[model samples]
Target: MTQALPPLLDDDQAAFISGGVSISAAACRSGGLPSMARATGCRIAADRRSITILLSATASAGLIDDVRRNGAIAVVFSLPADHRTLQFKGGDARVVPLEPGDEALAERYVDAFAGGLEPLGYPTQVIRCVLACRPDDLTAISFTPSAAFLQTPGPDAGNALRSGA
Candidate 1:
């Protein structure tokens, strides 16, 4: 018999739901994107009132590049609750690249996520802005969320915002 997974903490509650799978290590491939139907699980933690994401990957170099160019990335995983899948929409954040054996790298991720960040045992090549996008574009499956979370406005918000009500 398989051991039961623990209940999802509040941090894990806000995940990207694609079809029914949760985006986790098992769902993501080494050098490719996860299926849209697969749920990508990630922790969106707050630090000093700023939100950051915690991603686990065998190799994130390609993934980081994908996020930088596309402004978004998809993570797939299976949820333990009902054995269904889900995906979490990760919005773009700052990317910080590091060299191998950099002890300070983990600290940066931890600082980003606020709560303690756990090491995934994978060598990180680069960190890119994590962006939020819809899951309806997944190859195997097509579904859309009722709503989407856009990137946070920067200082340019004043110039971008419209005055009409």
Candidate 2:
């Protein structure tokens, strides 16, 4: 039998996901064509086995298609005030409709994100414009991470962490 793979994400990582930071989700398809979308919110499963990213329906068409066709995804979350970042690679991705309850999560995320942006010199209006969206236009992509990497700007930026080992 094979040794079990390590847990893909930790509690700290999960906090970053749902802590109202900027998230960028990407998917690649045939011939390595890539598509990306900014996520308004992130929700980690209670079991810590997966993540759900909330994105705009209109802006994520290509990304949705890419995930459907390839089932491969890479999500990057970056803290604006500092360059600290993490990237998670996942398989078994799927796009789904966001439920009614997801809207509140999005609202909380937008507010927290804007608060974080203030120290970075982005005004409230700019934050609103960047994250503004209607509930009807929101969709979710869920996936289980198979790999995680620390991408904070430094010598260790590209290094895969303990989980990916």
Candidate 3:
């Protein structure tokens, strides 16, 4: 029985996460060791409860396996220029196949990510190379955020995020 979780992200937070922020995820492997991976992109459901994060299958195999095993996941989104960051934790993660339009979404994410970095002195080509992935190697992890935190550096870094809008 899967109960629908209320969305933790408001409209503004949704928009921020949808943008080309840096995304990474972590899950625990056997013995509680952590597996981490860089996510290529993400999609927020219309209901604002479930968020699907795209990962490179080859690069994220360990993380994917951990998610499959434990269903516990934590993902972070951060803007390179401002250091604004958010962390979302969930205990109901699931690994799934990428839908048809996800490839385009990943490409757009890569473009926006590169644009965000170009102003910060990172070459666009270099940024693209760093996030490059094959379409066939793409996988998705979907989870409903049960907890949200402010991870940006400073006094309130680890505080629970209440509202941004």
Candidate 4:
């Protein structure tokens, strides 16, 4: 009997996918093209099977007096190795003005005092926080493997079998 193969991500080809660089690695595996878009530096409103990236754009002309506006960017991908396709949708992003002493506020959010004691002196605020809200900002990645490739077994398996177990 043929032994089951390990997950595709465990293969050498998967190294490129986790490197957080060029999408070409995944593309090659899927036998599909790769693409990328600039991240607006906005916080992630939500992350599920699909991720939402929020970006604030400047308003012009008679457009609503609101300076902050939301937009949606969609990404679709097919995983050839997995023989599956996925879709993602994102939108509902809003921009807000930068607040002063933002770094201090951020520290407060992350500060977790372990023991009970008098309030400790505040640390110097070194970061600033910008508020941006987005209900949805869609970006997607997918893959679809070829049937022939899926059915074919790697030579390594045959070698291991010949060597016993």
Candidate 5:
């Protein structure tokens, strides 16, 4: 019999995902082309099994279309200073309405992301521009990670991730 995989994200991984990091998403378009977009914020479900990403409906239109057509998605979160990265893959992504407080969540995310890059000499305005989104145009994409991978640049990069590790 095969060993069962970890059912949810461990505490450490959850913390990492909650920290100030740059979020981006990718979806496979029709005929295998790829659509990519920069995400403005992220939220993990209470169960730690699902993640919801906030994105600009206009900025991420192509990616949203791809996810609608095919539910495959891959999201990457990376810290600008250290380049620490993690990738989560799912085959059942879906676009959904934003929750009541999600607008504020997106605001905080933009602030934290800009602050994270400030020390590295990125102009605050530029950083904010990269993640700007109007509240009315914001959308959420939710997915349960079927697989996780360590995407940091190192010998261990690409290794499968396990909870509690």
Candidate 6:
């Protein structure tokens, strides 16, 4: 059986996701071709069973197509301040239509992302362009994580959080 994520994401995890940390999503083709793209923001489902990522279709055209063609995906969220990271692997990935206010979500994400980068000495304009996107072309990709692993720096990285196959 698949072990579900905790009933609620912990404070650190929640902050990392909502704080506009760097987001990267990847999907593979049945033939093993793979693609990836940067994501603007992430929303965890109410039930904590899934994650919805804000991706610009213009930027992730190949990754979006791969997810539609193959339902498996891997998303990694990392904080720019620290290398703290987490990866969620799922099998039910999909390219769903963006809901009404998702545009604002992306906007806030870009703002936060730029803020995060600024402290690290990156130019503001460069950071904004790194995640620029239009709502009309955005899509929400949701996935239920079938597995979770520790990806923090040090010896425990890659350790499984639960006992499962």
Best by TM-score: 3
Tell me the tens digit of each residue's lDDT in model 5 across 4-47: 55545777878887778999999997687899999998999887
Q: If both were scored by lDDT, which would come out higher, candidate 1 or candidate 4?
A: 1
User: Which digits, one per residue and each the tens of the lDDT, describe model 4 over residues 120-151?
Assistant: 33231321112221213222222221111211
Which ten residues in a row are the worst by lDDT in model 5? 1-10
Residues 1-165, candidate 1: write the lDDT tens digits.
011322122223343321222243212334766422211222232321112233333234445445445444433334333343333233332344322423333333323322212143322222122312223211111111111222223443223111111
Worst 10 residues of 1 by lDDT: 137-146
For model 4, the stretches where C-alpha displacement exceeds 4 angstroms are: 1-69, 93-165
Question: How do all models score by TM-score?
Answer: 0.31, 0.91, 0.92, 0.20, 0.91, 0.87
Which residue segments of model 2 deviate by more than 4 Å? 1-6, 163-165
The candidate maximizing lDDT is: 3
Superposed by TM-score, candidate 6 places the C-alpha of residue 152 at a distance from the truth, in angstroms, of 2.6
Alpha carbon lDDT at 81, candidate 2 = 80
* RMSD after CA superposition, every candidate: 17.2, 2.2, 2.9, 16.9, 2.9, 2.4
In model 5, which residue pairs have backbone atoms overlapping below 3 Å?
none
Per-residue lDDT of candidate 3, residues 1-165 (tens digit): 224434688898899999989999999976877999999898999988878999898999989898988899999999999999999888889997778899999999999999999989978897798789999888899998878899999998989875221
Error of 5 at 137 (Å): 0.5
TM-score (C-alpha) between model 1 and the true structure: 0.31
Ranked by TM-score from best down, the candidates are 3, 5, 2, 6, 1, 4
Residue 164 in model 5: lDDT: 28
What is the Å distance of residue 28 in model 6 from its true position? 0.4
**What order do you get sorting by lDDT, best first?**
3, 5, 2, 6, 1, 4
Clash count per candidate: 33, 0, 0, 17, 0, 0
* Collision pairs in model 6: none
